[model samples]
Structures are given as structure tokens and as C-alpha cells.
Target: MRDLEAGLVDAATGHAIVATDADGVVVVFSRGAEILLGYPCDEVLGSHVARLFDEAELGSVLAAGDLDTDAPARREWTLRGRDGVPVPAEVVVTRRPGVGGVPAGHLFVATDLTERRQAEQLQDELIGKLGHDLRSPLTSVLGYAQLLDDDTLTDEQRGYVNAIERNGRRLLHLINELQTGTGRSRSAWRGRRIRRR
Candidate 1:
């Protein structure tokens, strides 16, 4: 008797994994896939993945191609979970290439964005609140500096006001850019050339 290594990889590292054949039949379904999609590997392994994504056009851009050129189409699409709940998830398809650089099959690697999306929404709210909070102090500082810069004030006071204005401008720039999307690698985002840190 031959022993086949069965039943999932590390759940921590292996959350939601699905495999498909040339005909797009789910061949290897892991425990992680079950937890994420609510479908057992045994029940889903032979089924078409499109059934989960077809209603929402999840397989529209999908085709058998090399990973470098095709494979992962990083886009926001709705996926149908086992309970018929529509999940907003990001689908990443990794393609396998065989010998002679030909396309073989596809391996899908999915990271659930449900929680991440919620976090992003919360972050947006915090940023807005922080920006508004900072604006109040900034406005006060600007007003005080402007009053000092008036002809009624001395030369040294005018210089200090100018410095304050410059620092205020710098703070505004800091809030807008570096703190934003620079935190994540733009693997799915297009156009902008990434500068390596």
C-alpha cells in the first residue's frame, strides 16, 4: 500500500488553497479553502470553481496562461461562499508552467480581504479625524504667526512667523503621502513605478 500525504498543510500558512485542472475542476482542495469558503475539499475538489465566482464574473478574465504574463489577475470581485453569502474578496491566481515553458495548470492563492477592508475603512475614519484635529491647531498657529508678521510686530517676530509657516507646510505634506498606501506593495496596482526602499 502507498501512503499519500493527505489533508492540508499548516493552517496558519495555508489558509484557503484551491487547485484546478485544465478543465478548471478543483482537484486539490485544502482545509484552509473550506474554512474560507465554507466548502469541504471532498465536496469541492471535483467541482468547478466558477460555480462560486461565476454569478459575479469572477472567472471573466481568467484563462490558462503563464504566471509572468497572465495567472494572477488582482482585482476586486465578489465570491459566493457556501451559505450563499456574497463575499468581497481579492482573487490571486498563480499559474504553473511545465517543461518547454508551456502552461500546465493553475494554483490559486487567496488572501481574505474582508477584515483588511474593514481595517482600511476604520483607518480612513481615523485619518479624517486626525486631519481635522490637526487643522484646528494649525489654523491657530497660522493666525498667531500672521498677526506677529504684521507691521505692528518686530523683525525677529516676522522671521519666526516665516519659519512656522514653512514647518506647517511640511506637516501637511507628511500627512498626505508617506503615511498612506506606501505601507503596502502595489502588486495589484498598476502604472506607478515602485521605488525600492
Candidate 2:
């Protein structure tokens, strides 16, 4: 039984697990918490768990009732590392129960969000670059196609120009949707609409 208990404790230590009493005094700090926060377990074990967060954000979290709920609640928090720098963290808080069905404490599980945020930002930048590079050349193609809609063209030539104009409009619509996330592209431009310009 002791070995099984120790194994469970070891598993918890792999995550940034923290347990605090009802009044918010820290009761347990895990090894993963120490590594992530850069704080020694001794420095935080008996202190208030508030040391992990900025006062203003902590107040907001308290007001949001994220710390105590019948079920686990997850929210983003900027926790203070031992170096005094803010760490972007996503924390899940749940109630810890004691023997005899009494309320024991709160348990917190935290994960760093820095890498995920960075990846999302990078994706946005790449999308912007693709939109710019692609649309510039497409604009020139569209401008020249519009110039070809003159009456001097033969019937076969006019048919070719109509095809070009229709395809170009569809491409532009697709590009617009890509950047703006609007729904599906509208139907291809009508012949009269193309001839008007």
C-alpha cells in the first residue's frame, strides 16, 4: 500500500501540482512545480499560494471563482516565477477532499502556454506573408485581363477573355476568403459584369 501511494505521488510530481488548504495556505508543492516555477519546495510549501501570481490577476481569478468549483475549472494565469518574471500558464483548479467527506483543500495543475502561443503567432505572420505575395501578382493579371474586354476582339478571342476573367475573379475571391475567413466564394463573375469595365 505504501509503495502504491508513493508511486501515485511520483506521478503527481511530474506535473506542476499544488495543494492548498481552504484559507489558501500551501500544503503540498510538487517537484514539477519547483522546476517550472524555479522555486525550491521549501520556499513555498508553507506559504500562501498567492505567491504564484500577480496580485491584480490573482484578484481577478478569485472574483471569477476559478479557485473553487464543484468541478475542475481551467483558466489562463500569469504566474510569477522564482526569477520574478511572469510565466504564462494555464491552470486547472479542483477541490481536494479529506477523509469523512470533509473539504480538504484545493489542488492546482498548471502547464506553460508559452510555446503554443508562440506557434500561433508565427502562423498568423506566415499567413499574412502568403496573402501579400500572392495577391500582388494576381492584381496584375486581373488588370491586364480587364483591358482585353474591348470590342476589337474576334468571337474566339472574346471567349478566351471571358474564361480568363471568370477564373481570375474566382481566384481573387478565394484569396480574400483566406485572409478574412469569410465563407465560401461567390459565383464566378457574370459576362455582363466583366464587360462593364
Instruction: Point to the candidate with the largest TM-score.
Output: 2
Per-residue lDDT of candidate 2, residues 78-149 (tens digit): 889999988888998898887886768898889888787788677667666887888989888888989998
Tens-place lDDT per residue, model 1, 83-129, is 98876677677765667877566677666778988887787777667
Q: Candidate 1 overall Cα lDDT vs. reference? A: 0.65
TM-score of each model, paired residue for residue: 0.68, 0.77
lDDT (0 to 1) per candidate: 0.65, 0.80
Check candidate 1 and list the clashing pairs: 16-32, 26-45
Instruction: List ranges where model 2 is wrong by over 4 Å.
Output: 1-14, 152-197
lDDT of 1 at 197: 24
lDDT, residue 33, model 1? 68
lDDT for model 2, on a 0 to 1 scale? 0.80
Give the lowest summed-lDDT range of ten residues in model 1: 1-10
Looking at candidate 2, the ten consecutive residues that score lowest on lDDT are: 185-194
